[model samples]
Target: MPAADWRMARFAPHRTAVSSAQVETVVARAVGIFGLVFAAQTVPVALEQSEALAVGAGTTLMALLYGGVVALAVASIGKVAVTGTAAAFAVLYAAALAAWPLLVDDPAALGGPPWLYYLANVATSAAAIAFPLAASVAYTVLVPAWYGVLRATAPGGQADTLLATLDALYAMILGFVVLIIITMLRQASRAVDGAQDAALRRYDVAARQHANEIERVRIDALVHDSVLTTLLSAAAAETPEEQRLAARMARDAVRRLDEAGASGPRTVESVGLTVLVRRIRAALTTFAAPFTVRVVNAAGVELTVEAIEAVYSATVQAMVNSLQHADEAGRTTRRELRVRGVGTGGVVVEVADNGRGFALQDVPNERLGLRVSIEERMAGAGGTAVVTSWPGEGTTVTIAWPAGVDGATT
Candidate 1:
């Protein structure tokens, strides 16, 4: 992939230009804000009927219901308290309905539909937002049916049976509409979230493959232009001067090879640790397996090109080593990467895994992965790598530059 496209995939924006989470937030806020309006409309009716109901019961019911509405409205700005407040109001409204008869001193004194009628939709709407689909559906149906029953009774102003049934149908229709909209929005948002996650995973894999191909090309070029040329020059050497020159060429090739192993394509520039941290994080995402990552105060440190190359290469190698070797029969391994800034301007990266480890001393000389790729690579760039491992415990590779005074760990 082109750099631009890869970067676009890295962030994984939704295709519709609006994320599902954002849509859900908008819905929540809309419901919450509209709930406030409904609560405001009920205040006058509540005040008018206060004398007909028990003082304490009516006061407590109104206070809790209004308080829950206020909380829902405040939480509309974020997700923190929306569900809790919404659920509370849904139940509180139902309680107020059930107690309406007992609280009222005389049902005959009530002159209109009653303050509870104004809030019927509000409660069901809250339930739609907070409860599961089945529960919300039930609330949508039952709240209206209960209200219709109350409306047909003496306390509900003794309305005609047909009129009460119409009122119940109207409330149910509105409640179901709200419930359907919320459920659909939630389902759509969840789908968007899943797509973004899958897109990011694919991007990670593609990026890693691209990086590996680039490294392969670099190695092939070095073998053809540097290593092979040195070999041909040595074979053709006849005189002392020719032999000495071939030997010098061979030495130069080895140094170049070491430099190649130590870092990426050569550069004399420096970069902040923050950029290095980002690269490491991006690299980690490419792995099909999972691992915990912790970064602490790694932003401010400055590193020369050589040091950055060494640290990055060694850190990545450490993780690769863990992936390849950290496993046990019938046991799951846990791996972690921690990057942090140390005293003054130094940086440290630690890769650890709890797996079936081997004694460091048992590693054979032919296996240069640890000795050459990581340890010597760091040393060539004026850094250090300390690898610790023991049988049955785990392995930890700590790579540090400007060699350490231990830094903070996350």
Candidate 2:
């Protein structure tokens, strides 16, 4: 498309259709283009009513209205940056407007009927606002003053001083109306743009905060699953076999802590669900209590790094809780870790043991092992952890990430 059409097109006002920046630019362009079109009306008026263009140099005088119209028409390409073209046009227009009267009959003779007054003011209305606000204000006022002086001083128009002054004032008011409306719109657009930028900054801060919280939950669960679990297992050990298992737990805890401290946080990465569960089941063999692992339709399941880590840590913590707390002194500890698909694109994991169990409400908050390591950790990752236990029946801890939840394992 032509530059002029492109500039005018910028003013299309559909807010949903265009960006905020474009919406404001289009509004500004509309105002400028309207002023230019309003001024063009004077071209025909000059042709029908003015004798100044029929005098010795009248044809050239006639060309001022025509040239000014052309300049304003080109200037309506408002959206594009056209600094050089506009500057050249402004210079040529001023020179042409100023020379119009010099070529008229008896240039120094007393003014009569204020020749070309409306035509000149209309052209000024179109171009004068390209200046700074203060300059435009001065011109909007001065153009009328020039018209008043020219007409009021004319011997033939001397008796119509009041009419000449009113005419000048009328033209000035019309020009300022355009300036005022556009000024308000530009200020409003800037305010809206500023608000949009602020909202985006807040959103970024929130996203970062959410990520940090998830990281904290994962680390807390890891400590419960590894370091704390090892200490408790060492405390519960009676047989030499149990003692050896405790020693291994200590070694694993030491290595975990050493590696964690030596290296900064590792980036979260995807893990296969079946592979993760199998690893956990293999690790459980070292414990005094035996655990049976079952995978039901959970093969080939994939989950996000954070989801997998959170679930893995919490599940391990649950199994540790059972080994350390569930078994009675003279009873066989039979434990099961089951992972199964429970809903549409969802999974349910349970750590169950047949041993002495306590009431869920009786468990104190001081036990961060269950609250933070499992429940709170799951919640942070948009999942749930439920601990159900009675005085006699075994404790069952279920962790689930339901279908349609954000960041769910798929």
Candidate 3:
């Protein structure tokens, strides 16, 4: 495995602890099953070897010792101590196999229990399979090869040939199983790395979208609170002088908006309502005729970002609508655009004209300029759009929204 793959495999349990625990449980169960197999074979073989009772006893003792180690490994599950204990068991089993001939002089005459050797071989093979990489390979390969050669060279009895053949088969099978396990672990490691990479990409996309939305809200708020508010306030002014001043402010606002283009909204740390309104009004005045704007009651009100954007968009749409549908025959040089801040937490903006107006009921659904631009903007801010007009009396488009619906203002 590559270094990166190895590192990820080593630390995978930390990322998902529950999955790690489950894997440990599975390994423990496998170890326990191997121990049971060893015990069943060893106990029966011990009874059959009467002439070599000492050898049988010694083999039984070795089996019991290794069996205890396997039990401890399963009981602890995933501890470093399990590895140490398994290593010790592997050493003892290998030593017992090496000394088997000396312990049992003539096994064929006494129906030489080759089952004991087979049991020992299987137990040791399982230990090799369970141990970590380098260690598992070392034990599985070296011990079996050494025993096969020694037994072939000095056969103790008639059953020695059968024992040697079984040992060789066990060694080959164990080696193959280990290779398969390592291959599976490598594949699992790659899969985990791919999943993590995909997750990171999704997070990046979400973060960008969130940032864009925040910026849009900020710009909308600045335009509504400052420019649109001033335009609406000036429309309702009782004096000609106040009206003229408001008109100039609105003109300047339009100019600025055109220059800013659609760079999208930007969030600001702090904004003064009065100053922002002045800039907006100035920008609006620069737009063409039939697009009049008036700001009313904008003096002493505070608003959240979302509400401000809602009002700005609605007012802009209303002005655009008037400019588009205004009748030139009636000499309605400018449309009446009124934006009013009502109560402590709401705003009402109306755009009307003295020109010919269409029937509201007959308006086509495809004409969503007004629907999406005006109605949808307010609706998003938890507000509504009210339209009241006749064929002769012209049209009045009003948008209202409650303040503080978006989020807390700082």
| TM-score against truth, every candidate | 0.61, 0.41, 0.40
Q: lDDT tens string, model 1, 232-307? A: 9999999999999999999999998988876653323344575567567768898866879877665446665567
Instruction: Find the 10 residues in a row with the least total lDDT in model 2.
Output: 12-21
Sorting all predicted structures by lDDT, with the top scorer first, yields 1, 2, 3
Q: Is candidate 1 or candidate 2 better by TM-score?
A: 1
Best by TM-score: 1
Residue pairs with backbone atoms closer than 3 Å in model 1 (clashes): none
For every candidate in turn, the CA RMSD to the true structure comes to 9.6, 27.4, 28.1
Q: Which of candidates 2 and 3 is the stronger one according to TM-score?
A: 2
Residue 41: error of model 3 in Å? 4.1
Local distance difference test, each candidate: 0.79, 0.61, 0.58
Residue range 338-392, candidate 2, lDDT tens digits? 8875433456788998789999888898999999999878776667788878987
> How do the candidates rank by TM-score, highest first?
1, 2, 3
Candidate 1, superposed: residue stretches over 4 Å from native: 1-20, 233-410
lDDT of model number 3: 0.58
